[model samples]
Target: MRITVLVTAKRNPDLDGAACAIAYAELLREEGYDAAPLVDGNPDAEARFALDETGWARPAVSMSASEIVLVDASDVVGLPDAVSAERVVEVIDHRQHHDAERLFPRARIQIEAVGAAATLVAERWRAAARRPRGSTALLLQAAIQSNTQRLRGSVTTPRDLDAAAWLAGIAELPDGFVEGQFAARAAEIVADVDAALSRESKRFDHPEGSYVVAQLELPGAVGLVDAVAAADLARTERVMVNLVDVDSARSLLLIWDSAFRRWVAARLGVTFTGAGAECSPAVLRKQIVARLRGDAS
Candidate 1:
């Protein structure tokens, strides 16, 4: 009557989280565990595009598992309210700041600094000398690309490259699937700036102050930046949108706080002009927040 392991990620997860859930769950099942991947909320744009293209649908979760394994998520804040933190038995994440040790004191924790958590999951499959299904491999490969900005992101590692290369051989994907997946998410952000911002935004603690960082990866993100700025919504929190141009391997930080902008510039060595500043991919939102946590971000 109990599902042995329910692997999951943050609510409304991106491609990296969703793919890690499915592929990692497959690895668990292969090892004779009664496992299932639970996507507690809707998948983000890139994730939805990947699943739909691959003809895979996220499971309708029941939350009846005996144990929980967080794939891309590590903090209690990112998980669903229905999920019991105490039941978490394992965590595989790529972020530095987490409640993993405190909330899941009894759980096994594996946190790395790789670009994608999917990189870690792919390593797990390899360690067991197993091969995921073609679809799973494709999804994992796509997740690596998405999280790594086509493998050009700041957190990208040799292991990320190794995982993607290994999965590519097994993926057998269509010629344009990866590019299409990336384009779909960027187009969605251009279409609905408000929705995208609300969905993709995450709060952060900065040494200068507290701010929310919303991220989007688009080829030419200046127009999208203008659109988000013009929305005129009642934004109560200090928010900065870090728009990454994957094509250029650069980031544009959009903010209105002049003093805080100077602080960001000094901390990150980026110059500002008007409402936005063009910087390297090292200006990733989470990476910036980790700076406050004493990481050399």
Candidate 2:
């Protein structure tokens, strides 16, 4: 069967979105299917998740026209509407409530708030005893390590840990390789106020609706400027934004035009700081949705 794999993610190569797409494509090919990876945006760009490399020509235009589209969950933001709803499928992901059912009711949706989708992919590989060789294994390993935050993120689960251990054994990585990878990723974040404020921001979906989680990743020291900017940005972005400095681990939640934020704040007993800004969270959410719809926002 003709299958097209679409991997979507924020424009960051350091992320694991592209690697996950490649891993998925390899698995599908082994299953006797014609599978190719199609990433959103310019394949030759330097941005994150971009597919720029020699011999990596633009994927055949017909690839997207295939009968099946297996999307990397991170790439969900860049999905096109031309494909049939029945053909769209998703790999495991950390994204919370999404509009997947409405867009692709036939999609084999698999969402897990765990370490990384690569862990699930690895599980599938082990179950099938389909050993990946050389580059494929390396790529998958990098993806798993990166997504797990080097086994430090709160999302890391037992399944993720088991998968990592198994993959490490099979891949036989050198000492400190995994730790080095995590350190490199962490170092990419700038130490400025923007970077600090952006670090804690996340996106999630709930039955009531979807919202953005903004947190601050600060060192132990609290700065008034960083805190103020984070609160302003959260309001301007229009989603429920929370700020937390990694050092203090203190978090501030700002819900837009809803009592939920207050309730959460009170329940958590964390004082809500910062003057509310004028940005609309609904607008920001809509923008994100539009981007996922393949509209250039």
lDDT of 1 by residue, 180-250 (tens): 88788888888888887887778776565777778878767655766878754324446678888877778
Name the regions of candidate 1 deviating beyond 4 angstroms.
Answer: 1-3, 58-62, 206-208, 233-237
RMSD in Å for all candidates: 2.2, 8.3
lDDT of each: 0.82, 0.49
TM per candidate:
0.92, 0.63
What lDDT tens digits, residue by residue, belong to model 2 across residues 20-59?
6666667777877776655545321111322221123445
Q: What does the lDDT read for residue 203 in candidate 2?
A: 60
